[model samples]
Target: MLYRKKRYRINDYVFIGDNCHIGNNAFISSSVKIWNNKRIENNDKITQCNL
Candidate 1:
């Protein structure tokens, strides 16, 4: 996904598949929870994410 100063908020849980791509200026809040066994590839410009 392409995020330019955009925020992605996960209330309950988040499950990402393999070869997932996250673009620049992405914001994942601290309340968000990421599950195990998921793959996340951040190309560049990571903004906010507790994990």
Candidate 2:
């Protein structure tokens, strides 16, 4: 998902999946809650399910 200067209220959940690429100029509001349900795996680099 992409947005331009978007505002979010409190208790917002942002989920980024594996290999997910967040474009530039992405504004994630401070009030938003990033749960990150997907766990990152343990690897030499990063094996987590989510980026």
Candidate 3:
């Protein structure tokens, strides 16, 4: 797992798999799961799982 910046917010029940990259100002909502080898860009807002 790699984080591009320190500024980010991850809500409750968030699952981030292996080899995932979360960029700056990223916001992950509740119950959102990010699968493996995924890349979330800067200022991203994730509200659901990425399969």
Candidate 3 at 34: error in angstroms?
Answer: 0.4
**Model 2, stretches more than 4 Å misplaced?**
1-11, 28-51
lDDT by candidate, in order shown: 0.41, 0.36, 0.87
Cα-based lDDT at residue 49, candidate 1: 38
Order of quality (lDDT): 3, 1, 2
TM-score of 3: 0.82
Residue 7 local lDDT, model 1:
41
Per-residue lDDT tens digits of candidate 1, residues 11-50?
3344444455544444344344344443334433222333
Candidate 3 ranges with C-alpha deviation above 4 Å: 1-5
Lowest summed lDDT across 10 adjacent residues in model 1 is found at 42-51
Q: Which candidate number maximizes TM-score?
A: 3
CA shift of 32, model 3, Å: 0.4
